[model samples]
Target: MAPATRYASGVSETAASSPLIRRIAHLDMDAFYASCELLRYPQLKGLPVVIGGGRRKEDDLLGKLQAAYPDGDWTEDSFAEKLDRIPVEFFPRIEGYTGRGVITTATYAARQFGIGSAMGLMKAAKLCPQAILLPVDFERYRHFSRSFKSIITDIAPVMQDRGVDEVYIDFTEVPGGQREGGRVLARLIQKSIFDATGLTCSIGVAPNKLIAKMASEFNKPNGISIVHEADLQSLIWPLACRKINGVGPKADEKLKGFGIYTIGELAAREPHWLVEHFGKSYGAWLHEAAWGRDDRPLETESEPVSMSRETTFDRDLHAVRDRAELGAVFTRLCEQVAADLKRKGYEGRTIGIKIRYDNFQAVTRDQSIDGYTHDAQRIRQVAGQCLKRVDLSRRIRLLGVRVGTLVKAGTAPHADKPYIAAEETPYEQADLFFTDD
Candidate 1:
């Protein structure tokens, strides 16, 4: 929960006039995926809409629109313009959804039904049966992500890209950034994004990233929050320890066990007592976090550690009965991963596969190859070998393939070794049950 408005509205005259006061802003797109979907289907606005499930079939919405309005001048070239005309009744609902897919994001309206990101579709169905279920459209989402981030960089060049829909911007040096403790810059950014994309965002500006992240959530859906170093006690300390960003469920539970629920409680403990209980590094970090102290600067540029792709099936399938289908999907996943790696100019030596059974338990297997290459067939080969180590007798709900231990392509000594497949007998080739693919 957020504290009263005095902290957000008033910055101490002393701190405001200080020679140097760092101001960092965390901007998070509100209901990002769902909002992107709303742009294509404005009729769904203000209605319960959940944006997740599997990938959309090619021109599925176009086909539905054409079928529903045979005489309504719908053409492939004009499909984008006609999206807003789609009838709400034509959308898929969660009422009888049986998939094991989890939501990626949901509209604020649907969230009131307790539907949220990572929640199972079936479970969400029970809460909001009338919620429109749209398959994930990452292509559109990425376009918007790039658009907004580009705008942010144009305004604040020193910005850290956190993910597809969030960023930490250094407002300390930007013009007018210090006015009202960064609220002026935050409001300008919010308006610029909304004007460009018709999307909303919430921003929090604070002395550092730690408190800025928490402040971003204080007022959501196109709201701005400000917190100064002096407001730590009245503003930041009242929030739960879990809101500290790095504190996860396990840490929160352990903190609670020590009678520490709020940041205030954590702050009350002596640094030595916390170090003795939590450990040297984490304990010391906790004490600093509770006091809203973070000296880390924004990381403006970073390389990705790995890349992967995964999908949940419309229904669980047995390994033996679903071998052909599973094999095709398995091969496609490797191809997708390889395509991604090559597109990004990277190669990984480790190949891995993940399996989630009907019971929702997941298992992963991976092996390090002698050389790194972003070759689809080779990835499938090494990944197939890794797959042989997992139990396949049970029904599987989801599958994923990944490559890790990455390096830029051609940077490694054994980067591009030509792959020579061993000629195998039909029995051996078919052994993995993916030969048909």
Candidate 2:
């Protein structure tokens, strides 16, 4: 048997291993939405930018500024410098927000003030009064998401789409994967993405997905961490139990009641004890996860379950008093969702609608149709019926539409065909994805 060795960060040492030692990597885009916004407004690179809240009249402040100074010696190079001269009040801030909107995501700079995703805009306002607040732009984010994923799959063929901003990659078979315990390949993928999108991501390499997911966040905003099985006690045991991807708040609370505050504490419990406490299957999984043992493979091809579009209004709109505006917004949301499905080459059988009232109460309704479709008109008709099911008497602060139960477009010759397939890029090939025609 080979002596166990471990790798930390990028360096590797001899470590004990079983018959099978695989290399898995997890990559997470840092502040993805905020970073996408920065690509458009590079001037706000280091600023406390928050992407959340409803739309506001002042949301177009940057546009107004650009138009007002169009002929006034405005140039690309001096854009950031000029932004410094503008008054802070010109930008929309979370401070004093009275809407029922929630923060979709906040930049790390804004996170210092304790504001993060799912926080109420009004509550976040009290923490970072001057943070620049921007509305969510799903269409733009989706473009970047596709671009980055395409770049990754070209370099590493086996990848699992975790979400828009994160992915789990199987590095055991990729070139240079076993070299330096996958760090070399990880760096290649990271640099490739940055070159393609001008965005930074964090990568973590380990023996399996369970540990790789946790290690990815060890160093963030353009950093990488590598771990080996032998170092699990030192590298992973000390972390909080909630750090594990599957451990939610409820599980954490339940674990806490049994005096388990960290992964080590959970690991110390016997499997049978954990099973008795957390049920059989989950308890067994908990034991396996606590020991950093996971055999799940990368899912190379997984169709999306749903796609949706939503927006928060600057002010609440009544259903009866502002029926026309509400109806138009609803129709637009449905059309946007339909467009997303079409663009992604997916068709869904379920249509749904979401609404958040001014009083902070939210409701959703969905109906499944006989067949899958991506037609905007059909989506709007079905979504309109969903809207009728919800009580519209209350003033709504946010509106959304969704389509789920997705399947690949039947017009395709193969089920594995992507809407936008990855292509080989030559050294001289220019990246015009984000450039204006």
Candidate 3:
């Protein structure tokens, strides 16, 4: 079984010759979404479970329980309180799934069958048809994400929030940070998170972010690895060139063409040779990254440039036939994006819509307004206008809404002036599909 979560690492310049050494730790949560699901269905432990697709089958599950155990009075409340009572056979399997849905994450047990995140559900079914398929419950996962993150911050004040699953923590000043190269602090933080959320994570402590990021992958679930500045040649350079964080597929392919498949090969090249082939900035970055050199500070506070919400339908939906349903989803996406903006204290002037046709062709359109807003209706109105420009004659497999050109909610130039509201947004044609109706 492979571990789940991925946390970004920090950049440090600590060296053996320097008087000061900075220890940076990169922590990755193990199978975050699947682990959260396991907490709700403990009976599924040690079994192959994959989390993805549509919303949880609450009513469907309750109905199944009522039929299987007529005397149990398995209402929705009972189903929630007694989830463990449900038989394993009652759950849906990936065996016969027919959809464009993708897996968010799968349990370690499922990974043993070659299942992984971002793989289409249908393909996963081919690999492990008997794997239990569960719906993604982001609300529940977010609750656990906050739980574990709060625990980390309580122990170490200087922590970087990477995402819902992983984080980067500065261990230079904390007590016991230098003991065994930050292993003591790492253990404390890992134990604290597990104690609070019943979750496990892997940590890598090193002199800088680049090596730390690579080191975190050395151990699997609930493990730790420590690296020092002196270990760069032995532990880092022999890895593939792609192992360097900055090298993408294209760059790696180019490096391979130049007979530089390993980080050691990249480090051996003259800086001028790399700069001649790659761009000035990127090539220089490649040289530095290959040598495990980074001095970036952890970002404690940050602002987002945009916020969005998107969903892939369980089935392709026709624009006209699924008018009401499409309208509801589009409106929900707008509301969700608006809620995100409000929660983050941001408002945006640019609103956009993205859609994917059954043929897998995707289109995007955006328009900027005079004033910024985080209101759902405003976003829907603009997004609807953007949608009108797109040919929705084909069935849509996915829908998304985005709001960009953001500013702090009360900080836009026209903050005091009232923004004019446009006419209500309509779905299909002007009168054909999406409507208040």
Candidate 4:
């Protein structure tokens, strides 16, 4: 096979070999949600912890206790000692969970049992019943995200924010960026994040974004991997095609049907053949991606296309039998989505709802309104209409609400249809799934 590029970084034969090589680093927080929780509850370290579901009364009690004694002065020794006094049993466990919540993220230890983000808490319970469960705390996560990104920008100014836990940084120009093929800088960033937040991250530095993304996952959890152009065939080709990032389950299955399971196999096929099969744009992009050829630059700032919130029920909810519960949950989701839009200073013209049946079939319905609005009641109203459009005969396992076609709140709204049609067909659900690394 011809040479294929993979990810590499930090002090090696390739370091300083060529100043022209554009070094891009992808840094990902390891078990980010769980790690953030660990900062608040250091006692949970090394335990099988999962962060998901909703906040419980226990969480509220803890908050009150901590607020009453902000510095842990209630104890004789220190806050650490006071924290230790809290029994392990005080933490909620995934066992016997009976809600429609999914694991947001699991600690590496819990991940050993085949549970991860998007897996139902009930399903994860079957794998590791004793795993601890915590609620999603976006406020804390966002704080850490800003802190860590600030650290990166201080080291390497040209960084692109990719969600709340990852970033793409350009290391081609930083002072020590070129040294050791970007390892020195990666190490510094990792140490800086750990020192500031008591969290760990993994980084991969390569010639471009695509290679760097794959490399970041190579070692994982406080690991740094460096990939060079020369390391492509040896490091990249043997991996499964899905490791390429864009090759999702559906795409991977199609590739497998074609007897192309690895990057090497995908690269061997002619670009024209891929285009003929997968269509013009995506096919050609896939061919280039398989060959480890990507020239996309780091986008320092990009507006979000949409904001959404969804949840999977612990048990399937019958549309009629659980009407009240479902209605409340549906309203809450729309409220949450609307709040997200308002918090981000965006209003959207398109409102949509997603439903997944007990049989795993997923569907979506969206409608465009005359003007963009981020009001909770308005969103809930439109989303409820979208819900009415779907066939509610099957029991629902998952529900989601989305707001799209966004614009800055102060700006003029787009020209949209005066009224939305009520009978939109079902579409596949596109819930974001975070994987265990």
Candidate 5:
């Protein structure tokens, strides 16, 4: 009798027998919003630059700097050289700028002082008092986001966008995917992006998305890590439970009660025991995650479900006193949403607005239209209506506009013939019936 073929457990028999291995690359921008800001305001390059705050105050600071140096001679490298010439007071004051705005993103230098995204202005100030704080520039960031994604699609057609800052690329069809040359291809992509945009990113190459995401974060700020299936035990097992995608604070606390601190511990538990403790579906997902088994495909062709633009205030502004200024900002957001949709070859049927209050209470309102459209004027009108529904009694820290239910640009074609006869009759029968003697 012939011996049975030994297959890797959990993988499909067909897949195990096949010679091809699916290669996925997860590429994430290094401090995306903050990096883009540095490109425009070169003076912010080496310093700790925080992006997110009130528009007026940010603009005022930008105006002051522009007046002081109107010739645009500040190259990214020259910023540190001329640092002494610029006065300490020339830097924007972090104290009492606007309403209670939080940090959207902080540069590597600011992060060293224990400041990061979503940290309150008060806390961030305590960490890095002299860090250059700048308001978020959504338009500039969006432009760069589009540029990077477009460049990636040009190089690798099978790219799955994971938001403004990251993407999952399918490199299986690229040349030399199965060999050590895969690293070369990844390097080419990284260099291309840097050469084109002067921005840095980190990438991870793995057989699947689950492993790729974790590997990408292994190194930061212009780094790459490659993970092979054979090295899963050494590379993945030691990670903490919270490192897994779906393990939030609640799940982490629950896992801690079970003495499961690492992926290895979670993997050691029997599937039945995990199911009994964590319920059915989530338990199964947890088991698979522990084993690093995610089969989610890289989605290259789907339209975005939503397109949004948001800005964090430098200081929280009162809803009543800032109503007129906020209204103008909201209008600008709608226009940006429309432009984004048009550029991406999509139109949306739903328009919405998001407001985050001083206390961090977020409220949203949306309106669906009769048909999909990408007109900025139409979006603004509908979004303006949605804004009226939200309570404006409290101070708002952030405002955003979003369009959803996207569809491709072109309309569906209508067939000249009826479908009833075509479906009911066989091809040969229909051909005979339609033919003339």
Candidate 6:
């Protein structure tokens, strides 16, 4: 990798003359899931950490944490004492924990040994034998995620959530667009997140989302990189093809075959030649990506077309014998769906259900409501109706609920209508429903 170039000398001239000096910042949590684990077990700070587990185990751990520390202020020493009290049998064993699952996330320490998200657990163990592995505590992580993003919202109003791990923030309209204001604001946000959650992150300040995303990864854990428009050729052009957001395995392999392995090489290619080799749409996109031209906006609200929750059973249960048991699971799924909508400040007009039989045949059903809603009771009722339409004779391995036709929460709901019912049952709501709670 090439060293990132800086334009510290011509800041004034560039800011005044450049028409495309859009201030964008990309903030990514440093190994988010793994980092959250280490915050509790500080002894695991320098050690390799991995987070993965099934629904039940994760829920149980989250429930204990929520019950013990509702305020999210447990210290490192207190957390260590709590962990020591738990029995080893309750702790997940590498050999016994099995499934067709992949690692949800891993720490920077684990990444050093060539481990990463989506790698198989067995393979990760082989890479780092003594690595400390933990289950993904979705509820706790979601709580912290909301907390940090809310802090960012207070400082920078326009933010686009990439997922639980990262966000793209627009700082052009903020007071800190010129001078070192962007970097200064990024440092403050990073510090605030650390102080609030005891978690650290890497941030990149640049002219657009494309450059900002690339710049963020330039620095490792607990670091920042700022890239101005004038620094593009010296800094962004030398990166490998894989660094570009949309260039995946197939595109990378093809680029390598053509000896177009880096952004610099790709930029050197003729536009006509690229169009002839790749398709018109992709070829044009590749050329522009090389030049670091991205006009993507920073979205504050989440506009999801569909919302869903799914879990794989420890062992496949018979659909007939497990019908009663499945009811609880189905209700939990609906509650989670409703909670997700509430947190994102969204309401869905369409409700759907999905199931995967033991034979791996997937089935789905959907229904549109007369009005949009984020109420748990309404979502559960609609989901229940959809479930009855599906064939339940086959054994089920997984069940899920989905909601679509989403819009901003308050847009459709009248002031008099209560969106989320106060008496709604709390099934998986504890784990799935959290809005800075």
Alpha-carbon lDDT, every model:
0.80, 0.75, 0.79, 0.77, 0.72, 0.71
Question: Which of candidates 1 and 6 is the stronger one according to TM-score?
Answer: 1
Off by over 4 Å in 4: 1-18, 56-85, 302-437
Cα-based lDDT at residue 86, candidate 5:
56
lDDT of 5 by residue, 1-437 (tens): 00000111112223435665667789999999989877766656788878777663544544566678789655546654554455546778565544688999999988998989998887787777788877777777899999999988888887888988999987766765556625776788889999999999998888777888888899998988888776678999899989887889899899999999999899888865886798755775687688777655566555454687877676777666765576667667877988998898877767777676664445666676656777776777667666667677777777887777567765412222212322344422322111121
Q: Higher-lDDT candidate among 1 and 3?
A: 1
Steric overlap count per candidate:
0, 7, 5, 15, 8, 0
Off by over 4 Å in 1: 1-18, 302-437
Q: Which is better, 2 or 4, measured by lDDT? A: 4
By lDDT: ranked, best first: 1, 3, 4, 2, 5, 6
Query: In candidate 2, what are the lDDT values of residues 205-288, reduced to their tens digit?
Result: 998788999999999979999998887899999999999989999999999998899999998998768867997557767886
lDDT (10s digit) by residue, model 3, range 1-437: 00000111211111233333578888989999999988878989999999999887678888877887888868766667888777889888999999899999999999999999999999999999999999998999899989998898788877788899988887876887888999999999989988888999999998766777888878978999998877888988889988877788999899999999999899888865886799655765677677676645466665554677888787789888898789889889999999999998999887777676665445667777778899887788778877877787898877888887678988998787646555444333333224322
Note the residue pairs that clash in candidate 1: none
**Could you tell me the C-alpha RMSD of candidate 6 in Å?**
19.8
Candidate 3 error regions (>4 Å):
1-20, 302-437
- TM-score, candidate 2, is 0.61
lDDT string for model 4 (318-423, tens) is 7778876877787789779988998989888777777766644456676667777787767776776667777787888778887776788868345343223233
Q: TM-score of every model?
A: 0.65, 0.61, 0.65, 0.62, 0.62, 0.59
Runs off by more than 4 Å, candidate 5: 1-18, 56-58, 62-89, 95-99, 302-437
TM-score of 1: 0.65
lDDT (tens digit, per residue) of candidate 1 on 237-318: 8989999999999999999998899999999998768867987558767876887766455665754545677777877877
lDDT value for model 5: 0.72
List where candidate 6 sits over 4 angstroms from the true fold.
1-20, 56-81, 84-99, 302-437
